[model samples]
Target: DQQVKQNSPSLSVQEGRISILNCDYTNSMFDYFLWYKKYPAEGPTFLISISSIKDKNEDGRFTVFLNKSAKHLSLHIVPSQPGDSAVYFCAASPNNNDMRFGAGTRLTVKP
Candidate 1:
């Protein structure tokens, strides 16, 4: 069964604006949340990720927030650039052995 879901299949934003991607999971056992950005024909590249230990994590222009109680997570990209346009995936894992992925949300940044 699909435990992860990205309600919005796509998002559009202008350059210099912030982009927020949201994901929801039904599994409470998930302790790890990861965000990945995928370019056409290339494998998804790791973006921002967070563990249950922290409610939020920040890396450069990327940040991830987790609400354990709500079983929800969100990835935020500040001042999004055209290069940031890609398919983004949200993944949850209890451990490395089993990870679940949301279908993915395609983000388009227009200049």
Candidate 2:
């Protein structure tokens, strides 16, 4: 059974604006949160992540926030850029190894 779900299948943002991507999980045992960005024919690249113990994690223009109580997570990108355009996947793991990925949300950042 799939444990993770991406609420929105796609999102579009104007350049220099903020983009928010959301996901929800059925398993409460999820301890780690991760977001990945993928191009057409490339493997997914790690974007941002967080632990269930923390509410948020940030790296440059990307941030992943986990709301454990609601079993929800969100990835925020500030000043979204065209290069940031890609398919974004939300993933969660119980022990850092057994991870599950949700159907990705394609983000388009228009200049």
Q: Which structure among the candidates has the greatest lDDT?
A: 1
Model 1 — which ten-residue stretch has the worst lDDT? 92-101
RMSD, one per candidate, in order: 0.7, 0.7
Q: Model 1 over residues 10-99: C-alpha lDDT tens digits?
A: 999999999999999999899999999999999999887899999999999999999999999999999899999999999999995588
**Each candidate: what lDDT?**
0.94, 0.93
Q: How well does candidate 1 score on lDDT at residue 52?
A: 95
Clashes of 2: 0
Which residue pairs of candidate 2 clash? none
Check candidate 1 and list the clashing pairs: none
What RMSD value applies to candidate 2? 0.7
